[model samples]
Target chain A: MVQAYILIQTEVGKASTVADIIGKIPGVMQAEDVTGPYDVIVRAQADTVDALGRLVVAKVQQVEGITRTLTCPVVHL
Target chain B: MVQAYILIQTEVGKASTVADIIGKIPGVMQAEDVTGPYDVIVRAQADTVDALGRLVVAKVQQVEGITRTLTCPVVHL
Candidate 1:
């Protein structure tokens, strides 16, 4: 399984709504509004790296209010 | 309780070790090595926001090999 943390920046005053919408996405395990450089932090999982990339580009990015996303894929290392 | 995500950058080749040490901290719920701009991603909690900040500075950032840390505190709205 592939897991990643998606750090997101949203339009002004949109963090809560964006987090709420993202939390319901199929692969999202947790999505919460946060205060810092990024407005929302999301934990998600997929079957493979490619699928995880697609999930970020297709599903997560398409949500309204989102301005940017930084994906960090977990590694066993 | 106050929760936050600490995005960490570690010295080259130190990601795994940093994550290992951080995962053992008392307030840390999860710490994992990841591939991206940041080297490790950690989820932690404390009794208050101030306590969370102290946890990040006094504990998480003190770990050897860690270069930088950005704390994103979870917010209800």
Candidate 2:
């Protein structure tokens, strides 16, 4: 399995809602509101890197109020 | 506890060593090598936000080969 951490930036006052919505997505393992440069932090997994990219672009990014996302894939090395 | 996910960047070919060193820090819950924009990802906690700042600046950043760090603190909201 390929796993990743997605750092998200959301519109002001939308962090909680964004996180709540993202937590329900199939590939998402966990999503929570966070402070600092990002508003939401998510852990997700897919079978391949391409699948992960599609999950981020198609599902996660489509959510309303999201401004940006940075996906970091977990690596054994 | 004030918990955070710290995204780390390291010199070329240094992700594993950086993660290994960070994982041994007292406040660090976990640290692992990761691909994409960031080379390492870390989970850490402290009693207060200030202490968290100190932990990152004083300990995590002190590790050899680390180039940059972006600290995202977990929030209840």
Candidate 3:
């Protein structure tokens, strides 16, 4: 399985909403509002790298109120 | 408890080693090497925000291979 951490920046005052919505997405393992450069941080997993990419672009990004996202895929090495 | 995700950048070819070292630090729940802007992504917790800050600065950052760190503290809302 391919797992990743998705650092997200959301519109002002929308962090919690974004997290709540994202936490319910199929591949999302965890999503929480956070304080710092990114407003929310998400943990997700998929069967392959391509599927992981699609999850970010097709689902997570589609969520309203998100301004930006940085996907960091976990590496075994 | 104060929980946070710590995004880290490491020196060239140091990603795995950095992840190994960080995974052993107290309060660090998970640490893994990753591909993208950051080399390592860590999940950690502490008694308070100040303690979490200190853990990152005094412990996580002190590791030789780490170049930078961004701490995002989880919030209720």
Query: Candidate 1 — which pairs collide?
Result: none
Per-model DockQ: 0.95, 0.81, 0.92
Tell me, by TM-score, which candidate is best.
Answer: 1
Which stretches in model 2 have alpha-carbon errors above 4 Å?
A: none
Candidate 1 local lDDT, A25-74, one digit each (tens): 99999999889899999999999999999999999999999999999999
Fraction of true contacts reproduced, model 1? 1.00
TM-score of chain B of 3: 0.97
Task: Tell the DockQ for candidate 3.
Answer: 0.92
Tens-digit lDDT track for model 2 on B26-66?
A: 99998988877889989999999999999999999999999
Q: Give the lDDT of residue A60 in candidate 3.
A: 99
First chain TM-score for all predictions: 0.97, 0.98, 0.97
* A1-77 per-residue lDDT for model 3 (tens digits): 99999999999989989999999999999999888899999999999999999999999999999999999889899
Lowest-scoring 10 consecutive residues by lDDT in candidate 2 chain A?
A32-41
lDDT accuracy of residue B53 in candidate 3: 95
**Candidates' C-alpha lDDT:** 0.94, 0.93, 0.94
Worst ten-residue run, lDDT, model 2 chain B?
B29-38
- Residues B23-69 of candidate 3 have per-residue lDDT tens digits of 99999999998899999999999999999999999999999988899
**Runs with alpha carbons beyond 4 Å of true place in candidate 3:** none
B1-77: candidate 1 lDDT, tens digit per residue: 99999999999999999999999999999999889899999999999999999999999999999999999888997
